[model samples]
Target: MTTGLLIVQILNGLQFGILLFLVAAGLTLVFGVMDFINLAHGVQYMLGAYLAVTFVGLTGSFVLGLVLALAAALVFGLALEFLVFRHLYERDHLDQVLATFGLILLLNQGVKMIWGAAPLSVPLPAFLTGNVALMDGILYPTYRFALIGSGLAVGALLWFIVEKTRTGMLLRAGASNAPMVSALGVDIRKLFMIVFAFGTMLAGFAGAMAAPILSVEPGMGDTVLILAFVVIVIGGIGSIRGAFVAALIVGLVDTLGRSFMNDLLRLFMSAPSARATGAALSSMLIYLLMAVVLFVRPEGLLPARGRT
Candidate 1:
């Protein structure tokens, strides 16, 4: 690839990583602090995209639609927490998985019924509709640059909140030892609700942001959800810092692998065979990385500070 092409791919990988971080950040917290296995979290992402489409159609403004959709996503997530998730906190893992899996089916079907089984699109705002020159001859999409900036800003804000605030301290404490935190007079239940609701908003934000670039369809969140799981596993389940670092690693590895694997393989094998083999290996690269990580550092590269 040329230098410009390589630069574009690197930026793409960074943008992809940022989105994954947004989704995985909330998921890791919910799993780590609350000890809840929420398989339906991806549905929250799907709901965000759907809600954005609906609201944007009604308002005719991308910004307004995003705000409204995020709010709606938050409320919907809180409702799920109150109605379904709150009750499952102390249940067996099998039960949690089954219940949330049912939720995935219900919501996915519900979206299809309401929006039909077709993919949807969200238009870019006028101000962000074109590309900007990054170098003498290199240009990149304005909206994508904005997406990267936004994700980074949010990541920084999250880091500040988790690393420097009282709520964050409690969150860390809860993740390390919920019973002890409760014994110290913290309202553990309320904290958990806050975490879940916030995480829901983050996932929704990721979905809404991605709607313009990717197909906004019923099952779009499924693939992203699986990737988010991979991110957490590689980052260490409870560590935001780990999630951020690992997300970028996975994104760069996946994107770069796909872009160059065939070319690299062709250097040593027949073109046709190289293409086929490269495709297979590229897809498996991230999983192979995960297996290697688990074998080498089972607790993950940057495990949560207080986790055993």
Candidate 2:
């Protein structure tokens, strides 16, 4: 690949990694601290995009739409926690999976009914519509740079909150031993609510930011949900640092593999065979990476401190 193309691909990979981190960060916290399974977290992301479309359309302002979408997502997530998830917390994981999966089906259909089956797009704000030159001949989308920058900023903020704040200390303690944290006089349930709400907002913000780049449509969050799961597993279930690092790795491997596998294969095989082999191998690259990581470090690359 040419230098410019390679640079662009790297940026694309970084952008994708940032998006994955946003979803996975919240997911890891809920899974790690609350020990709860939320298969419908992806639905929160989808809802964010859908909400952004609705609000932005009404107001013609991207920033306002994003804020409103985040608020709505937080409220809706709390509602789900109250109406559905709280009951499942003490139940078996099988029940959590079944309940959340059903919610996914319900919400997917709900979106179709409300927004129609067709895909929707969000118009970028004027400041975000153009491209910036990385070099004399290379350019990248301004919005993507903003996405990467914002994700990094969020990552830093998340690190601060999780590493420095009282809530974070409680979250870490809960992840290590929930019953102990509860016995220590912390309202564990309230903490759960806060964690779940924060996670919902993060996932929603990722969706709202991504709406301009990806098609806003029904069931769009399913693939992202899967990727987020992979991210948590690789990063260690409860570790924010692990999630950030693993997300960037997974994003780079997946993006770079898809972009250049065929060309790389052509150096050793015939064109048609290379194309077939490249496509197959590229699709498996992330999973293979996951398998390798699990094999080497069962707890993952950077498991949380108390995970053992």
Candidate 3:
């Protein structure tokens, strides 16, 4: 790839990573703090996109739609927590998985029934519709740059929350030892509810942000959910810092690999063989990285402090 092309691809990867971090951050927290295996998390992301599209169409304003979608997502998440997830918290992991999986099916079908089975699209705000000059000849999409900036801002905010706030301390402590935290008189249930709602909002926000770029359709969150899981695994469950680092790493590796793997492989193999091998290897890159990380530090690269 040319230098400019490479730069663009890198930027795309970073944007993708940012979205992944947003999704994974919540997933890790929910898993680590609550010890709840929620397979329906992906559907929450899908709900965000659907809500964004629906609200935007109704309001004729992207910003307003975003606000409404986030609020709705938070409310819906809290409701789910009360009606469903709250019951699963004290149950077996298998029960949690099964319950959440049922949610996935119900939500997916509901989306299709409400929005139709066809893909939907959201218009970019006029100002963000074009591209901006990155260098002498290179240009990047304004929306993507916005995504990267927003993601970074969110990441910084998250860092501050986890590192500087009392709630963050509780989160870390809860992840490390929930029983001990509960023993200290902290309302563990309240904490879980808050985390669950916040995580849902984050995932929804990610979906809203991504709606303009990716197809707004059923099951769109499935692929992203898998990536988020890989991110948490590599980052170390319950470690926001690890999720951030691993997310960027996975994004770069996956994006760059898909873009240039064939070219790199061509140096050592015939054209057809290289193309085929590159495609296969690129697809497996993140999983391979996960395996390597597990082999070296099974707990994760930056495991939460005090986690046994």
Best by TM-score: 2
- lDDT ranking, high to low: 2, 1, 3
With a 3 Å backbone cut-off (N, CA, C), the pairs that clash in candidate 3 are none
Q: In candidate 1, what are the lDDT values of residues 1-308, reduced to their tens digit?
A: 78998999999999999999999999999999999888888888889999998998899999999999999999999999999999999999999999999999999999999999999999987789999998888999999999999999999999998889999999999999999999999999999998999899999999999888888899887888888889999999989999999999999999999999999999999999999999999999999999999899999989999897
Please give, for residues 1-308, the per-residue lDDT of candidate 2 as tens digits.
79999999999999999999999999999999988899999999999999999988998998988888889888999999999999999989999999999999999999999999999999997779899999997989999999999999999999999889999899999999999999989999999999999999999999999999999999999999999999999999999999999999999999999999999999999999999999999999999999999999999999998877
Q: Across residues 89-159, which tens digit of lDDT does each residue of candidate 3 receive? A: 89998899899989988999999999999999999977788999989988889999998999899889989
In candidate 3, clashing pairs total 0
What do the candidate models score in CA lDDT, each in turn?
0.93, 0.95, 0.92
Worst lDDT 10-window in candidate 3: 121-130
lDDT of 1: 0.93
Model 2 CA deviation exceeding 4 Å by range: none
TM-score of each: 0.98, 0.99, 0.98
Residue 136 alpha-carbon offset, candidate 3, angstroms: 2.0
Better of 1 and 2 by TM-score: 2
In model 2, residue pairs whose N, Cα or C atoms come closer than 3 Å (at least 3 residues apart or on different chains), thus clashing, are: none
